[model samples]
Target: MKPFLSIITATFNNEKTLEETINSILNQKYTDFEYIIVDGKSTDNTTAIIKKYEPIFKQKNISFKWISEIDTGIYNAWNKGLKIATGNWISFLGSDDVYLDNALDKYVKKIIEEKNADFVYSKVKLINNNKEVIYIVSDTWKWNQFKRYMKIAHVGAFHNRKYFDTYGIFDESYKISGDYELLLRAKSCLKTTFINEFTAEMKDGGVSNKNVFKAFKEVKKAKINTAGISTIVAFFDFYFSLFKYYLSTFVKKLIK
Candidate 1:
């Protein structure tokens, strides 16, 4: 029998934080899940950290599998994991992120309660380099909010296996907004539930946060291709988002 959940991490050169990511999984109160690490053939000590934890996972009777290879992008690595995930639900985490000890346990309970939900997403804490939470992401799921932007937290969000069978895997073409693109494929019909709890701590300086303009560009493309938005409308939204981003950055600098 397969596990109830499959957690995947696509990592590259994360030697400094991969061990903490692994340890977070090891410390999870909920144990009946599989953990997969898809490495982009890191030149650092990431593989050594993975190897060190392999025996511990096996000893604990958890199905832990990993692969180190050259992938085009994060979505490609995630697609590789999706192909072999033997679970009813799947989630992705970054190598620099970590789960709260009760995270999996909370999700399992929510899944049991919401049998009709295809996607379940919870709030995530955004931590600075010093590990202090700056803010929390993801509000309650609203169709209007989703239509405008990616309002749900992608990290640690649970996607039912059947959703993949119906809508297909993450679009490998997307470098940044692949998670949003996948959900946009479902359009307005995606059944979702929001859990009002912080499930994980995501480092503030991820690729998307660092490259705001590029990420917004991909999001606009995703809206046009998958969400049935007109190119003009998408571009307008993109520019508006860009304005907001710059305004916020300016305000932050002034406050500092």
Candidate 2:
């Protein structure tokens, strides 16, 4: 049987781009997947948008489940989706992100071809606020060097659901780097694969890029906890990342 994927999306007041995200999932060539959307009581047109698409999804016999309620944070909302998701494998999409055509079909093909990989990931195309392509980074990553940085993008990544019980859920306390923390914590236990094509297109202004210092702090803590590093070492990594983050952000602003 083809693998069933649970594509989870967490949204909050993202009326402008939610439509694109939802449409990307709905238009997938590979349809053996369920979409689990956890909304944080969006006080905008987000709920209306989801409601409008409900009948369409139902007509197609798609498993589309969503809930809008109060959540502590994005990762908390993600945990809710994870708890209710029933797919054999899972992937996440941001409210402002989109999957390229044939992303899931390629993912399924990868699964069939590479039987041992616990998770698979692909390349990502980053776009600025005006929808201009910024740069595409190589998705090829080594888990051993993860303590240096997150070489993978979440939107382009798929996870095997069976490992959730083994590694635990996203840390609700983490504001920006929860996914990184989860991946790092789960790295030693899971076998991962890197696909060769671009899977997702992402808008540049995610939480981590905007709040570099806070992200740095959370990532440092997560690295220390998961990698068994000394606080002193994590501290050095944090400051080094801090400098690089600010320098990159500054260069981008100058170019803009």
Listed in order, each prediction's TM-score against the native is: 0.95, 0.94
Spell out the clash pairs found in candidate 1.
Answer: none
TM-score of model 2 (CA atoms): 0.94
| lDDT for predicted candidate 1 compared with the true structure | 0.89
Collision count of model 1: 0
- Sequence-dependent TM-score of model 1: 0.95
- Candidate 1, residues 1-256: lDDT per residue as tens digits? 3238999999999999888888988999888999999999999998998999999999999999999999999999999999888989999999999998899988888898887788998999999899888988968777777877987788888999999999999888888888988988778799998888888989987444557888999999988888888899899999999999889888988999
Question: Cα RMSD for candidate 2?
Answer: 1.7
For model 1, the superposed segments whose C-alpha errors exceed 4 Å read: 1-3, 206-210
In model 2, state the lDDT of residue 237: 89
Clashes of each: 0, 0
What residue runs in model 2 are displaced by over 4 Å at the alpha carbon? 187-189, 206-210, 253-256
Q: Indicate which candidate wins on lDDT.
A: 1
Task: List per-prediction Cα lDDT, in the order shown.
Answer: 0.89, 0.85
